[model samples]
Target: MVTSARPQFTAFIGQQLLASGPLAEVAIAVMNASRNPAAPPIIMFADASGQPIDLDLRGTERDVVARLPQPAPDREAATEEASTEPRGRGRPKLGVVAREVTLLPRHWEWLGSQPGGASVALRKLVEEARRANGDADRARAARDAAYRFMSVMAGNLAGFEEASRALFADDRRRFVSLIAGWPDDIRDHVVKLAFSDRAEP
Candidate 1:
């Protein structure tokens, strides 16, 4: 999926890629394509999750764009507002949520002895775990996203099952070989989604 301030989408007519960009542009392309009586079915996909996107392309380009979901609130502005808010009598609002932890006695003792007590210690531990597993997590997400798109677009193609197995096995070479005979656009897009985080070998 796309990683940017604005999400991106891709539209394909059969195995031919029609458009790839921000939602408005893709939606406009789809709208235009739909006008052709002989045009094949158009499928749109959200780049981030590789999920199919159903567009409301019934009206003008302007109407289609207007129907798109609104962008999320500006995070920078929200952070600024939160920082400038007046503090109450209690601890400063650090956006910390209180949740119960069910740890053994020894675990609690160790956390209690940490420099910043249980909460800080727990946060630190969680952060460390995330850092350690970050690459694996990202790779897994990419694999899943690619699989989702492949299931929709290439499920009936030759070697689809083998390609899927190779994908989950993290065998890039095998996956590529398995899908070598598929349509160019579909193969290329699958590779892009499955290995966006990795350098080309």
Candidate 2:
């Protein structure tokens, strides 16, 4: 069974963390609290990624329940049509889609000269590029996510400037030290998001 990605979110009530978890749970909690005027106005943000989750909670409980995942549609019919016939010449067994790719004359010439023609060469090149840059891409994404969360939550807090500097400098220890005095929930959450994939020195 393929597990779906569960994006974590954190909800806040006037700088204080109210709830943190999957979007559906956080949204529902915020929605319920919104019913009471005396409750602090709630704002929800996605973890590390720093994007705000805008939920329209103006619905009945049953309506909200429907938003959660139900049983996936049965794919038994799709499974049966599996491997009866041989693949055609143009369409390979791997289900390769043919799309138009515009290239300059020299580029086309270079690709056509490669083994197994331009398509195979292009695919190999793309795969090689992806493999080479994969780690750096992921690290950059993590840094951006951490920055987003910090900008929204701790932008005005003390040591924020220093923390931001440490973050961009890739100085993990200094960053942790700078944010040590932050609220327990905020500090912990930020640390988890920022350094979850990083190694301890």
Candidate 3:
């Protein structure tokens, strides 16, 4: 879903923006449109700076263009430069295909040495790796979100601890009065963790 959000404009700089001065105008455009990775690669490359600066994109355009996807590599371009180049091939994503690969005797021996694993078809390995990588990325995002919540709540621990203690008090009415309005996220976690604490006689 996220990848689908891309930019369509690639080659053209609008007349007004071109007139306004090169890097100064386009840089703003790129910052505004970063979320849309599919946008024309040229526009994105030109405005990478959050704010615009005065420069002729024409004079500097060669450097800017190098950063963008090219229709084809020039023969004079170094191989390393070619490898780093973007193909500007449009948003059509070609998936990595899985196929059998011949393994050297040492490599085969290495595969056998792995614990909790055996030689799997290369297709399975590729698919599983993609799935695992996706999951790790999602997990990292969730961890960051949870940590933000934890940071806010960590500042209010004394209040939560007091409310939690109130819930364990002998006087039911007093306990109810004490924790009547705790933050829902905190209350939910506290209640679950303490649910077993009430089981004993």
Candidate 4:
């Protein structure tokens, strides 16, 4: 569900942040760091999901960039193409899917009485539900993303388990306190991922 027109990445060498930017930049940075025998292993993470990304850093910068995964088809471009095409449809292509819905007789009667009938009423209800749960949904997603990152990067760190529990419990103070002794970069990234749903103190 994490979609971004321009995806970003963060790279770290051990506990030190190497680079944070687009894939091309991070790939080049990783390539450069790999040359140094003293540098620790480098890891690149997707900023959106806090999941590690493996890049083929086997060639020159241009070659590496060329081998990067192609971006998904832009929704805007698809919409423009659809707009230009001749329309001979009953309803504009809203990408609506028809599905069976079972409801009580009273519910059906209420839906049927709405301004745009059952479909519109159902869509409105669904939208309202989504809006109502938006904050909780975002918080859940942030917790999951933070957990994924921590499981890989901080699993062996002190208080990691307690920090994870506090993360899911939405105890910002306790979570921060638990991770206070972690390396600066790792701790900051964890905080960024865990509290991404709202501004961090």
Candidate 5:
């Protein structure tokens, strides 16, 4: 049931964070609460990558969610198209496309020599690469996402530089130690964003 569409978010009211969780709709609601003239000048909502999410305050909550980026089409569903006609040359019933791939002569020769032809070989190579790099890719993404949140919310805090160093180095202990003095909500949210994808020690 894993889906790339699930969004993660954090909200801030001035320098103090208000909440961190899924659902941009809820984040927008929290941001709205702090929008009065007397409140802090900046009420921001950022995604897991720390990019600011623009919410049109005049719209309904559902409208706000609808404005967020939707997931790409399901590949499996797209490939399942039922057709009565024959597929054309270089076209696949699996929805494959025949794009010109410029490869060195030797590379092309090697691919052509594979059992099922260049296309099948290339697909196998791609699937193997994805399987091999999946974990590393997810870890790198987590680090980047956490760093984004930290830069926006705690860049000026004490030990931020050291904390950042520890974060990139994957030294969880040192990172936690450096940010221990930050406000409870901010510290907790940072830890969650950084480690939410990682398994417990």
Candidate 6:
């Protein structure tokens, strides 16, 4: 628990009829009077109507205590939970390494549009995206890796399917990359189709 004596900021509504002076000046004066030397520094602002506000600064002992957020018992627990929460994991896990990445608005929106849903496991989503948008090299490698994928990780196929679906749903990069990597055999099949249509004519 962080138990540091510090000043805080706060505000109060002022009644216009009692307006004996400038509201901003009154707020600053109150804050100055309320601030504790031993506590942290605090800056307060006026309400929309411009009135005197009260803020509580912590730890310093003084005749006038600012109305700062008081130290509560559960505060420690809440802070612990917040500090330990993983960045993008959506929740905390014991042994997992959590990493942070910034996504554009469209990426988030697309993720939200996936079928099995957004709350779906991110690992699956990421792998799916990797697979769906996999390059021709990846496709060839994946085809080559098919034996391994089947042999070593067939048990995880269901997970692969779901993630692949999400990734493919909106991936243009992988879409272009993987198609560009089509194997010779698949490329030949397309050539064969064109020749067959001409031959039929």
What order do you get sorting by lDDT, best first? 1, 4, 2, 5, 3, 6
Candidate 1 colliding pairs, count: 2
Better model by TM-score, 1 or 3?
A: 1
TM-score of each: 0.77, 0.71, 0.22, 0.73, 0.75, 0.17
Tens digit per residue, CA lDDT, model 3, 1-201: 112212122112321121222433444444444436565432222111112123223335355444544333232233234346574432123222344768898877776667533333443465578667765554344333323322333335435455434444433355345445655444333233333223422
List residue ranges in candidate 5 displaced over 4 A: 1-5, 19-24, 41-47, 74-101
Q: How many residue pairs clash in each candidate?
A: 2, 0, 6, 0, 0, 12
| Overall local distance difference test of candidate 1 | 0.85
lDDT of 6 by residue, 30-113 (tens): 555445455433323321211224444334435224433343245335446655765555344323445675789887787778
Cα-based lDDT at residue 35, candidate 6 = 52
Please state the error at residue 19 of candidate 6 in Å.
88
Best by lDDT: 1
Give lDDT: candidate 2, residue 11: 88
Assess candidate 6 and give its lDDT.
0.37
Model 2 pairs in collision: none
The digit string of per-residue lDDT tens for model 4 on 1-201 reads 333358778999998999998888888999999989998988999977889999888878898999999755655454455557665443335454576999999999999999868876897798699778878777787788889988989999999989988998899999999999999999999898878657522
The 10 consecutive residues of candidate 2 with the worst lDDT sum are 74-83
The candidate with the higher lDDT, 2 or 5, is 2
What lDDT score is found at residue 119 in candidate 2? 79
Best by TM-score: 1
Off-target runs (Cα >4 Å) in candidate 2 are 1-4, 65-103, 113-123, 199-201
Error of 5 at 103 (Å): 2.2
Question: What lDDT score goes with residue 31 in model 2?
Answer: 83
Which ten contiguous residues of candidate 3 have the minimum total lDDT? 1-10
